[model samples]
Target chain A: MSPLLEVRGIGKRFGSVVALAEVSTQVSAGTVTCVLGDNGAGKSTLIKILSGAHRHDGGEYLIDGDPVRLSSPRAALDLGIATVYQDLAMVPLMPVWRNFFLGSEPTKGRGPLRRLDVAHAKEVTRRELLDMGIRLRDPEQPVGTLSGGERQSVAIARAVHFGARVLILDEPTSALGVKQAGVVLRYIVRARQRGLGVIFITHNPHHAYPVGDRFLVLKRGRSIGEYGKADITVEELTRLMAGGAELEQLGHELAGYGDVTALDGPVKSEDEQP
Target chain B: MTVGQDAGGPVPAARVRGMLARPEIGALIGALVVFVFFASLSEVFRSPAGIANWLDPASTLGIMAVAVAALMIGGEFDLSAGVMTGSTAIVTGLVATRLGWNIWLAIGVSLLFAVLVGFLNGYLVMRTGLPSFIITLGSFLMLQGLNLGVTKLLTGTVLIRGLADVPGYHSASMVFASTVSVFGGAFRVSVLWWIGLTLLAVYVLRRTSFGNWVFSVGGDVRAARNVGVPVVRTKITLFVTTAVAAWLVGTITILRLTSIQANSGIGQELIYIVAAVIGGCLLTGGYGSAAGATLGALIFGMVSQGIVYVGWDADWFKFFLGAMLLVAVLTNQFVRRYAEEAKR
Candidate 1:
């Protein structure tokens, strides 16, 4: 089957600087496409282009093999594209149900007399979260009360509930601890299992390695490498991501010159260096 | 599940239980205390006649208070709202009495102007992305100038008069400002409008999709937009709604007195804002209630009228108002902190 979303030769520019240059990727249903990058590697720019926040200066975006233009975020949403940012994309003071039903709230009446059906919204919020295996302490509790990991889960579940076929998460686990990151990785897997195409953006290869089906590494706004899960081992991926030779040079520099005991251990192991 | 294992587990009934234990509780207590304080000070305050009297002012303030609270909860302010009333009233009076237009037609025209002003406020704020305080402050000054300059030019005086002689004036006045007998004493028709508007606002805020948007827009506009909420449109509509409320209040005031003063609604905007904040609306937006605003208005009315019944100098009203504002804001801040801490 064709992939859910396809980006071909997409490039974006901000004034004089090139934020992205000819980045291309494909996201398939039931798979996590990890876009790994360091800070300022144009991860945000790429996500914005994908989520319809910014238009690519040059590119072809296809949904089901038909070229499309997303003029705005609303346009992207209509096309079943949902992007969850690192902040969890929610109002802190609103109840979970209200946050869930914020944008596309269901209405009962036809026109001026139309009103929100709170009961229905609440029911759906509960059912949707439960279906995603996320149990909230109280649906009425403000989302601010939720932990960092739980908030990301809610945003993920929200995208799923809204019928998003492609889920683009922007550094979803960047601010989280090891355990919290694990929880989010679990949800990414869950979303993928439910047949939704997930684009997981993160800097940590360890966090992405477990659930990622395809890995695309970005360095300074360009795709440095793309590999399938079976082709790239965790150690190789980490070495490449950490800039293997540069890391070794830095380690060597940090070691006290020619002092065996001061160097802590071996300067270079046979298998460790490139 | 054991309490330890369920430490972060879903608390089945905790939401409602938590609500009762927090800021909502403080608001309820404050409302009751104000009610009791007024009731004990004045014998008439406990009677139907006193209820009608207090409710009259309460209703007028209630209508504006509710709208202001909604806007405040959405994280914006309409400084022009108070003077916009004067502007609308002057427009209606000048058109009906001086221009010889039908009273209803004049009212419609006046409302259109009010809507335009509201649109301008919303449009400018959104377009410029400035703090609404600065934008609405500019609007307030511009309208104040227009209200004074235009009324003076049209009427050759500071006040526009002769509205009582305009065609359909009596019926319009009866509908908009005349008294209705509720128990023994007559209650202002505006009071009925206020209560009806309050109910409508409550329904919109609590039970409707629009209410959800209001909360979301106020809570976090970027988040709301990211999730596909129409942030700009929601805010624009809110501004328009607030202006319309101002027009209604102006119509009631002018028709009741059969005259319009250029400065009639001057200085009332802050009171509406104060009432809204005291009623539990966050100045930063994202949390509030229309009923809370209405109750806040009631507190204002009770205090405003209660001072007179207790035989105190009316001059002290300003001092009382300042104190109420300070105390209410301080209380609201404490409650907000409590809510935030409780959420953690």
Candidate 2:
């Protein structure tokens, strides 16, 4: 089968500034595609292009081998392309169930009497969260109270439940602790297992390495390379992402400030220290 | 699925606590306290006739307060709501008395004007991206001026009277103004209207997708828009809802009094907002209840008249209102925090 989503030589520019140039990637069904980049590496520009927040100025974007143009976020959603941004697109003060069913609320009754199926909504929210191994004390509780990892999970589960064929997660664990990041990684794998073409965006190579089936690296506005897991190693990915030569220069510069003489004078015997 | 480890579903008691932590709970408690306090002070306060007398002002104020509460929850404000009331009242009275139009026709004309002003306020706020406080303050001043200037121009006086003899006056009054007799006490029909409006508002806020949009828009506009909550339409409708509420109260007032002063609803906008705030609405938006707003108006009704029954100075009403507003906002802050914290 053709890849679920493919962007070949996709380019975008704002006036004289080239945000993304000659970028290419493919997300196949049931596979995790990690888009690794540092800040200003055109990760956001590429995500915006895919999510229809902005239309790419060059090249072609194809889904199921059919070229499609998405003019708005709604247009992206309609095409089953759900983008969970770093912010998670959640109303902090709204209840969990309400946030769960916000855009496409399920309804009962008919005509003017049709209303949000609150009981059904709450029940499904509980079941869906439980399925994802998230145990909330109360679904009625405001989402603001949820920990950052939990909110990200909720946004992911919401996208999954709403029939997202292509899930683009923008730095899902960037704000999380190690354990929380682990939780998100598990959810990412779960989405992949459930047959979504997942685009996991993160600057953290460690977070991306374990779950990613394919890796795409971006530097400035161009693609450095795309590799299947067997073709690349984590150490190389990490060095390239940190700009190895630049980091080595900084390391040498930092070593000069260590001051061996000052350190030697600081040592003292046990009794003489007082 | 691994919840048997340690994490389990919420306990029944926790769920009960969650319910109690709703944004309106504080306002509900405040309403009960005010009711009991005033009831204890005046023997006449509990009387059926006294209840009817107090409920009259509450019905009108409650109508506007609930609308304002919804708008506040949708993350906007209408400083013009009070003057819009007066402006619509002027339109009704002038059209009926000066233009020799049927009372119903005058009411229709006034409603159209209300909607126009509402749309204008909503449009300007959305288009300019300024705070509604600024936009509606401008609307308030202009409406206030138009009310006085237009009434004087048409009626040769600041007040329009002789509406009692207008065609369709009886039927219009019967619908909007006539009183209902219960237990040998007469309560204005507006009371039922208030209750009905409150029920509708509560239902809309609680059960509908539009209600969800209101909460979403208020909580975070960018998030809501990203999720396709129709932010602009929801907010615009909320503004229109407030203006339509003003028209309703204006209709009830002019029909009951058979005349309307150009200054009829002047300065009352703050009172409606105060009532909404007293009902636990956040000034920053995203949390409130229509039922709470109605109860807030009820507290206002009780204090505004109950002071007379107990023979205290009526000037204390403003002082009491300000005090209630501060206390209510403080308590609402606690409630909002509780709502957020209870999950953990």
The model with the greatest lDDT is 2
Each candidate's clash count = 1, 0
Report the Cα lDDT for residue B216, model 2: 90
Report, for every candidate in turn, its global Cα lDDT versus the true structure.
Answer: 0.84, 0.89
For candidate 1, write residues A122-223 as lDDT tens digits: 888888777666765457767766667777888888888888999999888888877777778888888998999999998889999999999988888888
Once fitted onto the true fold, the runs of candidate 2 whose alpha carbons sit more than 4 angstroms away are A12-18, A56-60, A67-69, A258-274, B1-20, B338-344
Evaluated on chain A only, model 1 obtains a TM-score of: 0.87
Q: TM-score chain B for all models.
A: 0.92, 0.94
Model 1, B234-308: lDDT tens per residue? 899999999999999999999999998899898999999988877878788888888888888888887788777
**Candidate 1 displacement at residue B79 in angstroms:** 1.5
The TM-scores, one per candidate, come to 0.88, 0.92
